[model samples]
Target: MQVKTFSGASSQEVLAQIKAELGADAVILSNRTYRKNGELCHEIMAGVERPAQQGGAGMPVSAGAAPAPSSGAGWSEWHKDWMRVKEQLFMLMKPAIRMERLTPRQRVALEYLQREGVSDGVSIALYNMLAARPGASVLESLAGIVPIRSWGAAAWPQRVHLFAGPYGNGKTTAALRCALRLRKEKPEMQIAFINTDCLRGNGRLTLRHWAELSDFGYLEAADAESMRKALALTAEADAVFIDTPGMTPERNLAQWQHEMGIDEQPHATHLVMCPFYDGVQMQALLHRYAADGDTSLVWTKLDEAVCYGALVNVAHEARLPISAISYGPELKQSLSPATEPMIWRLIFKRQLPIQSGE
Candidate 1:
């Protein structure tokens, strides 16, 4: 990998420079903002895979060309070695899971968490915590890993919020519900909606209808230039909620955001998801939507899920705080700001956030 650092007056400027030098396949490693010479500036570190050499001539291979015959075998061997190491580690840890050391209640709770789909790694961590601190409860241990950051003006002070997720994950509805909640809490706040999921007629219409009915500003942007224009027009609004399209197999969130100019601004991106997806699918979605900016998780369709194990797994894996959750079929009154009590109820008690009036 070829890594480099870039700094400029704005994130957009630095991002443009990185792309110009490293092309579209660059991966952002880190980014920060600081005052340089009495002026605010953004710095970004990015890396890209170096092109493979061909024919011993040091010539770079084209992206679409076939790789050397040995490349597939090399990758297969590497994967096998990795799996063996993981298996060995798990084998070593299995002997330490002494269920008899815990009280009957703790044992049952730990067993239940395992049945609910919590991974072995997290269960082991919880076991260690309980064994070290006999006074701590299972809920306390879980809370340390699964954090909650309630969604509102106080928790999220950013003016622009972007909602992105897989197809049929209810990103549009979540965005609308957030806007409604904001309007109810702060009636004087000027809110706007920016739609980038133009490929779906139903979602686009729904966003436009709600924005018009609520008397909030609304615009549609299909690409970077239009998005720039839309942002410029909504610059006066107190808050802007952007609804993004679901990522296709050919597209990536980071690259798409960079191309649309969304990464250039200071904003928050919420990854909307559902709890019904299996662990493998959830991991794939998380990997696909990973971003280097302020991002949080928004779970939807809690009312339809049979097991909430994916929730714990995702929180432990992504380390992103839960921002909000949605249940039921209604757009209004179905979404709630995530809190520890609410999350624990859903995971341990099979209770939805809206059920407890959270």
Candidate 2:
């Protein structure tokens, strides 16, 4: 793991520097504006965590350690403070439907969801659930309405994991993160990479670079025949990641499968997305990318998203399960298996989950 602080003129410049220095797997700890040399500049703290280069026991290792996860007490206090601010903000506005006996906090919380891009009906459902169960309100609201499916290493039923999503949605980065995490946990296990995204030259180079660094086999395939040969050749590996180019449902799913020579055995597709996408865009993407029940949702760019309700709302409405989430440009601690509390925090809290922990 390596950590560094970079100063630049703007947010984009700092992020580019982080990505360039730490690669896509780096995680951002903090970003702020400060005066450097009597000039206004932005500072960013970023880090990278990789599997131990010369280790056998699979010990967790990182170059830059981030702040510990917020304790339960601290999280509660932050929620309470946000509630107060929200109540004050809404006090100036009139309620569309006045319901007696509703607490100000409850009303404000409802508005918060609306602002987070939830539909009116879905927001009302969440409000009613929270109102009925004041204790552990967020947990109760999500448990009954949405599913947080687990995709930890133990959940991999197939040897071939397929990553597919819209271009620029972070599929390549997600693949690297997942691959490294798996290797870290199971050092003795055999791993390999099979890239089907042949059209993207830069993406192919990035995957190959990681392969060279990690000392794993990397292969590329363009069509069904080549993919079939790649799989047959890597049959000895325990797990293989198959990365594809941007796929949309508007295209022929069957034809695409045929072109890739995809088989039912030992294969599963995961749709990767950024949580900042609005409801309409998400629905369109899901309709095209995740039409099958087997496809699970993996969110990226959690730090960039101002709110996460729309992502959850789309999943709930479509009956899709959220399998994982990635928070920043840094690959270290960028992705994690999804959980109920995680969804709750992403919806209500401004801070991103800062670590990859239990």
* Candidate 2 local Cα displacement, residue 215, angstroms: 2.6
CA lDDT for candidate 1: 0.80
Q: Could you tally the backbone clashes for each prediction?
A: 0, 8
Model 1 is weakest, by summed lDDT over 10 consecutive residues, at: 62-71
Best by lDDT: 1
Model 1 regions more than 4 Å off: 1-88
Compare the candidates by TM-score and give the number of the best one: 1
Query: Local distance difference test, per candidate?
Result: 0.80, 0.67
| Residue range 1-358, candidate 2, lDDT tens digits | 5779988986667766765665544556666788878988978786665545522222232211112112223433333333332232223122333534356666667677778777644655565566566543555666766777766568766788888888998999898888887888788778889988888889999999988788778999988778888989999998898888886544533346656767544577777888766644664565456433366778888777767776657666566788888877777667787787777777777555674244
